[model samples]
Target: MERDKLVYKLKEFQALEAYQVDLFQSQIKSLEDPHIKHAFERFTVREQEHEVFIKDQLYSFNGGTGIVGPAFKFAGMVTGKALDLLSLKDRLKLGIAVEQKAVQMYHEFIEMTRHDPQLKELNKYLSYFMIDEELHQFWFKEHLARIENIEAQPH
Candidate 1:
């Protein structure tokens, strides 16, 4: 991939990571369960790390960390606020859906980097990010199952 195109893609991913960090941070404030809140806090930290990594990559390519688009920023905030009103199970379901999409996006990016020798390091980092997303999706799925199981049990 051309350097300019790669940088553009990196900027997009960086914006996404930033959005995830903000979304998770907002959700953490709304969560009442200590365990779930702690999990979201950890996720927010990891997402921040991912954002920094992408920003570093952008810097290396001379692509300054550009501001996220106002529209995208607004959408993330709205989604996060809407999610805050959902029940725990509904929130977990949405989390699973979002993580699944993120995992797929990372997978596509990893594939794109595969054919370019210069992008190997970026590919490795993306793989790590994908695994983190998968872990998050797994946590959401497990928590949802537990909630469903308890609801199904005889009173």
Candidate 2:
């Protein structure tokens, strides 16, 4: 992928991660279920860590390259508002959906770079992201299943 296009998409995605970090943080306080709250706390920290890595990647570029760090930071700050608007169950479902999408996007990026030897390092980094996304999806699904079970029980 071209650096400009790659950086553009990456920064955009990175911002989403930042949004997720915030959302997860809020969930820590809002979630009543101990299991779900614990998971949210775990994911929140992971999201924050990913934000730092994403920031590093975005910062590696200069404006002359048509992709800047500050631009990405601003863009990331704009995402995840919809999560706040969602109900608790819907929020977990949406998170699972988004994480699935993230995995797919990383897969596509990896495939796109398969023919380019220059991007091997990038592919490696993205593979780690793909793994993390999948794990996040699993955790979200687990939380949903647990919540659904709880909701199904008699009061």
Best candidate according to lDDT: 1
Candidate 1 CA-lDDT value? 0.82
Which residue segments of model 1 deviate by more than 4 Å? Answer: 65-80
All models, RMSD in angstroms: 2.7, 4.0
* Per-residue lDDT of model 2, residues 1-155, tens digit only: 67776677677767767777876786576677797788888888887877787677766743425543444343223234554566778878877877876787778878887777877776788788789889999988887898899999999
Model 1 clashing-pair count: 0
Predicted structure with the largest TM-score when compared to the true one: 1
Each model's TM-score? 0.88, 0.75
Please give the lDDT score at residue 110 for candidate 2: 82
Which ten contiguous residues of candidate 1 have the minimum total lDDT? 68-77
